[model samples]
Target: MVFDIGIVSNKKILLVDDEEDIVNLLETVLRKEGFKNIIKAKNGIESIELCKREKPDLIVLDIMLPDIDGFLVCQEIRKFSTSPILFLSAKDEETDKILGLGIGGDDYVTKPFSPKEVAYRIKAYFRRHQIGSGKQTSYSIGNLSINEETGEVYKNRNHVILTAKEFQLLLMFCKNPNRILSKNLLYEAIWKEDYLSNENTVMVHIRHLREKIEDTPSKPKFIRTVRGLGYKLVTQENI
Candidate 1:
């Protein structure tokens, strides 16, 4: 049971896939759902360019691409933007799915998936971010601002360009603030129902995010490694 009752009509989405049929079908489905701004990129390289130009609210990315693999593209995308990423790959392995999420994707939709199901999940994700007389998506720590609705993040009134995965990782930290989030916790939250996974996926994104937002990534102020505990976000110095 999904409803777009409070949703804005002009939402934007980026659909990235090498397969034309899949892109066309998903584009059609998104158009029918009231997303007026739907952009398309056939491969990972093109996807990066589209991201720089359009800055879509969400992205539908395939795991496999003709030029570059989806994971690598995801890593690179994490460098500049933090939009929500939903893997649209055909690989159905638990490890793969987990790996995608762990890297920066908010959700994973297997190939041959129902358009309606994808729509439903998208709706749910949107609802989760809507700030009204309901669940609020905006989060802040010190000068950082995170909008869960659009998956947009900012710091000190400045738009912090974070890759989709970096944004995801930031959101998890901001929500908990001082809680020491274990690597496993992070890995699982991003990649629900993993189809494949490797430890490097999470490590790479973490390093990238630190470089972008931290005053001294080597000596982080916002996101800190808790030695044996993992990572946490704190506004003030640990006393």
Candidate 2:
């Protein structure tokens, strides 16, 4: 059977962050957006384990956590899942937002943000699945396999846990390997405009990803930088 271009309802979403007020507020917001099944986690560690079990369709993550930072959580979750991740945090710095995106966040929103806007952005993403037919499929390069349907990645056939955003970044690279993805292009693709700038997000996520998939992050083999250009994934040559 062919899958749709986007994912639609009845699926659950895992909401993770260290703040109670934010969690509760988002839970309510998600419900208002027609996300009936929602799960919550207070910190990065809890988010990781929760993802291993519940397997929500998407994730709402925070950058600052009690145990691990959200970026690492994004890395950890990317290990085994591809659920869409949207960041909600007070760390509105350009670097912080880019870190979330470059690591693979689908979207980023700073705290004191508009809940209505966030909800609207999410619905737009989900709409992709609701529209297209034949479904965007999955593929692999060497030991790394991507299941476009589930948005999950595997290394040596072992599920690599990743936050929703990390999965998105990886997916973008996988789809357009060997193409130099400029920082601006990446920022636009991941986080909708009106919320991005030159910073450490892409660099951080690329570093984090290198740590995971690269045999040697210092000498990356999969995702490579073009120095003056951007980043590209190598099908054969090392980065």
Each prediction's total of clashing residue pairs, residues at least 3 apart in sequence or on different chains, is: 18, 22
Worst 10 residues of 2 by lDDT: 1-10
lDDT of each: 0.76, 0.75
lDDT of 2 at 126: 70
lDDT, residue 58, candidate 1: 82
Candidate 1's residue-wise lDDT over 90-169, tens digit each? 88887787677666676778888998788766666666555555455688777777887766667678877775557768
TM-score of 2: 0.70
Write the residue-wise lDDT of candidate 2 on 111-201 in tens digits.
Answer: 8887677767777767644534548688788778888776567889877766554566788898897899988887677655642554466
TM-scores for candidates 1 onward, in order? 0.65, 0.70
What value does the lDDT take at residue 190 in candidate 1?
Answer: 58
Off by over 4 Å in 2: 1-8, 15-25, 40-53, 61-82, 91-108, 128-131, 134-136, 194-196, 237-239
Best by TM-score: 2
Can you tell me which runs of candidate 1 are displaced by over 4 Å?
Answer: 1-8, 133-239
